[model samples]
Every structure is written in C-alpha cells, then in structure tokens.
Target: MISAVVFDMAGTTIDDRGAVYRALRSAVEDAGAPVADADLQRWMGTDKEEAITALLELGGVQPTPSIVSATFRAFRATLDDLYRADPPVPMAGVEAALADLRARGVRVALTTGFDEPVVGSLLASLGWTVGRGPAHTVDAVVTTSDVRAGRPAPYMIHHAMELLGVEDVHQVLAAGDTVVDVRAARNAGVVAVGVCTGALSRAELEAEPHDHVLDGVADVPALLAGREARVGVA
Candidate 1:
C-alpha cells in the first residue's frame, strides 16, 4: 500500500494556463538570453533560479549571478501580475482526487518547483489549506526554497517523505507532468508516475523513464486502488 503520494502543483493539480512558461520565457528574453520552446520545456518543473541560469547558459549567455538573479526576479514579478489578473484554478478532478486520497488514510503531499512566497500566493488564491485540519487539503508541501536543489534531484521528494512520516521509499509514489519530475522520483527510489495534464503529451512523457503515464491526476486514485488490490491478492 502507498502511504504517501507526492504531486506536482502547476500542471498536475492546478491549471495555471501556462502562465509559468510565459513568465519564464519573458524573463529570459528580457535578460537578452534567447530561449527556444524546446529548451524552455526541458526546464519545466525545475527551480526558477536554476531554470534561468540554465536557459541563459544554453543561449550562450554567461549566466552570471547578477543576471540570473535579475531574470528570476523578473519571472516572479511577471507571474505575480499574471496570476493577479487571472487567478489559477484547480485542474479538473484534482481537488476531488486529493480529498479522496486523504479520506482513504493515504497521506497526500505537494512538491513543487516554486518558492515559498509563490506557493503561498497560489494556495491562497485557491483557498486551499495545508497541514492537518478539517479545512486542509494536503498533509504537507515541499518547495524549491525548502531544498538545496530542485527536480531531477530528489531532495524535495525526500523532504516530503520526511515531513509526512513515510520512511520507506517503496511505500511512496511521486507524480508529475515533466521529465525532471519523473527523474526526481526515480532518484528518490520511489514509484514514478507521469501525468499528461501539462505541456507534455502522453507520448512525450512516456518517452521518459516512468512507472506509469496516466491521462490526468484524477486517475491516480484508481491506480493506487489497483496496486493495493494486487498486493492484497498476493
């Protein structure tokens, strides 16, 4: 049985209408660093600061500390403005899925590439609470700001496990919509699931190493039930 499940925020659970990608592209361009669609997509589900530096380097820019910092700040400001104009909404069936998982005694945690301030604003916009309470939607949240490194490094996932009191990696499942997310789960030695609710298509996500590639976050509950049933039969 899976004791805890960690989910990615933006494309997986929240439908932000691709605002993050737009903000990232705009920031890199404003910093005079050319960013191709493919390059930017590859950096999706990663820390904003690391993504900026990587994009700058890929574009032949030096990616000095000052430039990276400036670009990151620009990205944050643009995202804040965009979200203010049009607040993010929960992805179809995601809130119900979260509630169902929690009701089943499965601990649900959210891990994201966003920092604390950004996560706070996003959650506030959705009116979702964290921690243990009747009003809470999730058990814990792990963000880039909480870890030294972001996706493709398992720090955030491991941190979520720690926070949720899930000790065995085999008892955990991590799901997201990006290659880095899958990589991070694999690096953490947990079940890696890819969902096609984000920029990447099912085929694109399937091309990466993953345990399962589902159509959306809503399918997660059924998947977990199937796994548990199989275990019971065994």
Candidate 2:
C-alpha cells in the first residue's frame, strides 16, 4: 500500500498554461542571455535559482551570484504578474483525485520547484489549504525553499516523507512532469510516475526512468487502486 503520494505542483496538478517557461525565458533574455527551449525544458522541475544559473551558463553568460539572483527575481515578478492576470486553474480531475486518495486513508503531498511566496499565491488563487487536517486538500507541501536542493535530488521527496510521517520509501509514490522529478523519485527509492500534462510529453517522459507514465494527475488514484488490488490478490 502506498502511504503517500507526492505530486509536482505546476504542471502535474495545476494548469498554468506554460506561464513558468515563458517567465523563465523572458527573465533570461532580459538579462542579455538567450534561453533555448530545450535548455529551459531541462530545468523545469529544479530549483528556480539553480535553473537560472544553469540557463545563464547554457546561454554563455557567467552565472555569477548577482546575475543569477537578478534573473530569479525577474522571473518571479513576471510569473506573479502573469498568474495574477490570469489565475491558474486546477487540472481536470485533480481535486477529485486528491479527495479520493485522502478519503482512502492515503496521504497526499505536493512538491514543487516554486518558492514559498509563489506557492502561497498559487494556492491562494486556487483556495486550497495545505495541512493534515480534513479540510486541507494536501497533507503537506515541500518547496525548493524548504530543501537544500530540488528535483533530481531526493531531499524534497524525503522532506515530504518526513512531514507526512512516512518512514519507508517503498511506501511512497512520487509523480511529476519532468525528468528531474522521475530522477528525484528514483533517488529517493520510491515509485516514480511521470505525468504528461505539464512540461513533458508522453514520448519525452517515457524515455526517462519511471514506473509509469500517465496522461495526467487525475489518473493517479486509479493506478494506486490497481496496485492495491494486486497486493490483495498476492
């Protein structure tokens, strides 16, 4: 049985209409560095600061602390404006899936590359609460700001486990929409699921190391239910 399901926020659960990628590209370009789509895709699920640094380097700019910080701030400001102008909506069936999981005694957590301020704004827009209480939509939220490092490292996933009191990695399922998300789950020794509703497509996600590549977050509850059935038969 899976004790917890850790999901990525932007693409997996929330449909931001690719605002994050656009903001990142705009930020890097405004810093006199050109960002390639492929390069931007590689950093989708990682920490924003780290993504800015890597994008800067890839764009042939020296990723100095000042430059990275400036670019990150620009990205944040752009994203905030974009989100405020057009608030993001939850992905189709995501809320129902979350409710279904929680109703089944499965803890649900949301992990993201966003910092606290951005996350707070996003959640407020969606009117979702983060806590272990029955009224909360999620058991916990682990952001890049909460961990030493972001995706492709297991720290965020491990932190979520800690927050949810999930001791065994094998009892966890971590799902996201980027390669780093799959890598992070693998690094954490948990089930890695890739959803094609965010940054990557089915073919792209299927090329990575993952246990399952689903169409969207809404499909997660059914996947877990199948696993439970198999376990019962065994």
Worst 10 residues of 2 by lDDT: 196-205
The TM-scores of all predictions, comma-separated, are 0.98, 0.98
Give the TM-score comparing model 2 with the true structure, all chains together: 0.98
lDDT per residue as tens, model 2, 76-146 = 99999999888999999999999999998899999999999999989999999988767999999999889
In candidate 1, residue 63 scores what lDDT?
Answer: 95
Model 2: pairs clashing at backbone N, Cα or C within 3 Å: none
User: How many clashing residue pairs appear in each of the predictions shown?
Assistant: 0, 0
Candidate 2 deviant stretches above 4 angstroms: none
lDDT measured at residue 63 in model 2 versus the true structure, 0 to 100: 94
Q: Which sections of candidate 1 miss by over 4 Å?
A: none
